[model samples]
Target: MGTRQTAIRRGTNLPRMGDFNESVVLDAIRRVPGGLSRVELAESTGLSAQTVSNICRRLLDHGLALETGKKSFGSGKPRTLLRVNAEARFAVGVHLDPAVITYVVLDLLGNVVAHLRVPTPPVADPEQTLSGLSESIRQLIEESGVPADRLLGLGIAAPGPVDVAAGLVVDPPELEGWGRVPLRDYLAEETGLPVVMDKDVIAAAIAERWAGAAAHSGNFLFFYLGTGSGMGLVVEDTVLRGVSGNAGEVGGLGAACTTRGMVDEAIHLGVLSHDFTPIGPRDAERSLAELCRLAAEGNATAGDIIDRQAVRVGRGVCAAATLVDAELIVFGGPIWPHVADRFLRIVPALVEKSPFVKSLHPTRVTSTEVGDDVGAVGAACLVLDRTLSAQPQSLLLA
Candidate 1:
């Protein structure tokens, strides 16, 4: 099929009597800085006052939150205060790519306590790869000397399109026969921890929106230019997972010869080979990396190849901006920083000169400081945003 699409099937539910009670209460308190009274929480959440009181007590007891101060606005007297501890629990985030896997241990406040990187498996074998990942997680936890129980769980930023709900790598073209691999289940079973999965670009966008530059922009496009290219859209702090959960597969937007008037320039230039692997998720990383190095080395032939790639990328961005109406575009893939200083200088001009830019200025394009770790860090942020937000299970743990 020309388009990569799949049905997102749900997994069996894990029991959770207290999966997110304290977190919900704490997030509410943090929203209303001065601290919300039990009555206010009840009014806001529609939970009974007694339920709110019980949750607040648990939060206070666990040291995840406290009644810093009290407020008086009624005749009967003021209720005790409640606010997020901001230093309560911690989570481990690991982003796995073909080249490297980045590990970040973040605190409740989203501060990075430690960050590390290790090489990924050279070959694609699920059993071997997952065993190494389990070892990595254990080693990082042991080396940091943090109690395993203190960690909420692990969030993995997986490369390529994934079935987030079921935690499977569905039809990953880059990996040999990786289709329908139950990654989440394998990792969770091996590590004895709950694992959450997200597409790398989507995870990167989550990290950017939660803590990076795009945090302020509600409607933004995250252009993840890693070994390959992908995009993610965040509309009002929420990711837009289109019909088949493959909304941001920009590489598959179809490579037309935008450099020339016709599409055959790519064919004539020999940059793309039909006999080779199809330009699906399977061969993007290897192909793009070779092209980036050639372009960087000032090889005229390679430069021409990359120029065509850039034009195609810019056109894809234009199409994405038009379709999603994203206000800001942030670049955060591996290739960006290598040539960002030079790339940015020419991108806006090319975009503006395009036919689509006549009315609306193409979305603002900028580099992300998050860099290579964007996906892994974003994986961790997904956990935090899930366990610490008003609706705890709505995003991460779900």
Candidate 2:
């Protein structure tokens, strides 16, 4: 194959020689919210005026940016103002859960142009779910009137213990009976697009970093509080996937809390059910919610149970913060609303007293706005980011 053909096959979007300069220019434009004129772009990019003009012309011709207005000052010639045309490109996000499957179509600006939610397809056959997912995506694309070329790709956020590097999902506790499924390859084949797979919690963290609570900050933790709790860590804008890609499994940490006599306290407080069936973070949230409702109605049993659960959760958070050295912690998933108030009031104290954290140092804890769609949105953003920047590390489609 020729060099251009070879580059395309390799999935490298830019030619080797001038890719850095092109990326720098694009990033500069992205940073400028209202976009920059040619002259202003020159100043911001540190390129010569002629170079900026050339780049702007090329970008405009490529439809990456649009001329929106004209700016004139000091009676000089009016310069055309530019802005990112988010609709120029698009991405799709899928959140696959045991109970529901959510699909969202997002433009480059992270705006949802379309969305679909339905009961999860039967897992006994596996193909049933995949086919349903494919049909749903096709319906969304057809209804949206978005061209096939503009459809960047799809992102899948699934239950965890995923081998992200291999694009496979291992045996997930909640999603039992699904043996190491080739989710990335299957979804890509079904949609005729590239599909990226990630743990639900990790994807939520990515969405928060891009469009929600942690939009500007780094070194934060995203706790996806569901039937199971999953954690995603971000250090300096990159999601930290540990050696095994299972970095933030906090359920195991509860065993450590047992040493502190918190387990019995949890059961006694009714935050944990006396029922022997295995429970997870979602169960904790459910218990907390029940307690909160009772507390709202002036039930002492509910109030005390919630208070005890808050302490246990705080212990876990403090442990994670100390180990990861996270500067901020964000909570999302089903349990957040139930425990947000209690967590906000109690976690700080527990973290402050912990030996792991530095004396007098504070870790900012907050709730996430992305909610359940965090995974889907983050997945879409993942593809879009790769498409725009063409970075080797952030591959969206295979």
Candidate 3:
């Protein structure tokens, strides 16, 4: 039998040859708030005037951009200002947490048009959970009033060690039935739209650079603390996608923080055991709530747990900084708000005490300022960034 080849479609775009030029122009216009004139676009992109004008005409015709107004300076002619038409396109972002699911619809401007959250289906049944997710997406589209035809695609942020090359989620015990699942295939078919997937933290890092606090931060790290620890990196203004798309799975770094009769692993407070039961599975969501409740009541055990986990997280940050020299480090995930504020304070202290990082320079550590929607918003930004952001790496192709 002939081999069945599957093609992953990441939305549609211009042919490869000319897309490079179009992408460059689009990126420049997106960066400028007041928009740029033909001359300005040509100057910024290093394209000839005729080329910029041609590309501009194409973008405007496609509704990706519009003539906002005209500008004049000195003896220069009043040049027509062009700006991106944010409403021209939209993207759907879904964050598939083990305990909770978050969905958001974003216009081209990275604004959340609408968002909703619901309890995630049990991980034991992939088909049923995915069906529920698909229906939720349809409901979102209907409620948000976003034209389905204008959607770029659906982007999913999930726990990783994902085989992104083939769109498979690998061995996430948190997602019980997701062992090597062809998630993109199932979701794309279910939702009737193209799908892109990445680790939740990685998506959060992209969101910051696209629309959050780190819009201008090119080299930074995002430390994700939710059900557990995860990390994402940005080097030279691009999110690092390492082999298998799981470059920053540093949760194991907390091994040193494990306690006996807990995870048989790290002693960090993130290890959630019901009724002090050792070796039993933990409910991360309930653990989070419990930890917060106890900590608020001045429970030293819960407070100490958070501190120890932050130390491990800081050590991981030091490792990344020494290896790649990240300039900024941002923290996000549901866990941050609950216990990581104390974690955040302790992280910097630990980092400063480290000989490696202190010898080079102190890496800036901060929590995400994007609110509770960091993961979901990042997922939406992933679609926009992949489709429109300037992708210089494509030049490596023949």
Candidate 4:
């Protein structure tokens, strides 16, 4: 028998090289809202003048960048300025919470073109839930009227314990009956687009970095309060996803601050009647909302329940902020809107009083600027970040 020899082809670096350079140039233009000149792009990205010109030409031709106007600097020739064409590309984001699933279509500039919120089906069957989610996404995109070709991809912000590598949603505490569902791959196949997944808190943090409260701050902590609770840590402008892609799990802090925990506590303390006992994620939210109403109406017991939770949250965030040396702490999630007024009043003081936080640098405490739908917005940002944003990790070989 004759043995056939197989030739192994060596991989070339040219394929990713142009993409990386283009991303760098695009990122530079995006940073300057008013726009940047080709000279400025060359200077900022450390690319050659010809390379910048070539990239800018490609960007303009692709409708990703536009020549906004012209500017002259110190007797130099008038330089044409280029800015990102926000409408040129779009991304879909789905935030899968236990109580509700939020869907949003965002333009390249991170502006929401359209959005919808639907109560999550109460069924424990993952297939049924997945079908509903897929349909909702399709409806949203169709109703929004965005060109399918312009859509970069879909992103999902799910609860913690997500296996990001495998694109699976592990057994999240709040999302029952979803055991190791291949969310990313399923969505990618269903939507005919690339899909990315991250923890909801992490996604929220990325959202803030992209367009919300942390837009100006490189180091910050996003304290997310929803059906459950957790923190998203960004240090030195890099989001920290540990070895397992679950870096922000608060463990006990999350248990102590969950909406369900608060509702249960209210019931046990007689602040809320047994009839108010939560039967599901939405029930917990409703009960918590009622508790907030009672507290606002001068019910001391209800107020105390919320206040104590504030204290616990405050302590947890302060420790995290100090640990990561974050300069800003943003709080938001579905449940945050219900408790923002209360949390702001208490958490800020605790942060200001922390010796480490106060003595080193002022840690600004604020709510999310991305609104209550930050998770959804962040989900979209995952696509934007992956496709557009220039990161050092992209240079590493697979």
lDDT of 3 by residue, 154-246 (tens): 999887878777887777756776677787778899899989999888998888877766665677888776655677888877788787688
Best by TM-score: 4
Clashing pairs in 3: 257-266, 257-267, 257-268, 258-266, 258-267, 259-266, 259-267
**Model 3 residue 359 CA deviation in Å:** 7.1
**Regions of candidate 4 where Cα sits further than 4 Å from its true position:** 1-17, 46-50, 72-78
lDDT of 3: 0.75
Segments of candidate 3 deviating more than 4 angstroms:
1-17, 70-79, 255-283, 358-362, 396-398
lDDT of every model, 2 decimals: 0.67, 0.69, 0.75, 0.87
**Model 2 lDDT per residue over 80-190, tens place:** 877777888899999887656788888876778888888765355577777888899889888888889988899888888889889888886656467888889988988
The TM-score of candidate 3 is 0.83
Residue pairs of candidate 2 with colliding backbone atoms: 226-282, 227-282
Tens digits of per-residue lDDT, candidate 4, 171-223, equal 98877788899999988888888999999999999999887887767789999
User: How big is the positional error of residue 316 in model 2, measured in Å on the Cα after superposition?
Assistant: 3.7
Worst 10 residues of 4 by lDDT: 1-10
Q: Could you tell which candidate, 1 or 4, scores higher by TM-score?
A: 4
Clashes of each: 3, 2, 7, 0
Instruction: Give candidate 3's root-mean-square deviation (CA, Å).
Output: 7.7
Which 10 consecutive residues of model 2 have the lowest summed lDDT?
A: 1-10
Which prediction has more favorable lDDT, 1 or 3?
3
**How far is 71's C-alpha from truth in model 3 (Å)?**
4.7
Candidate 3 or 2, higher lDDT: 3
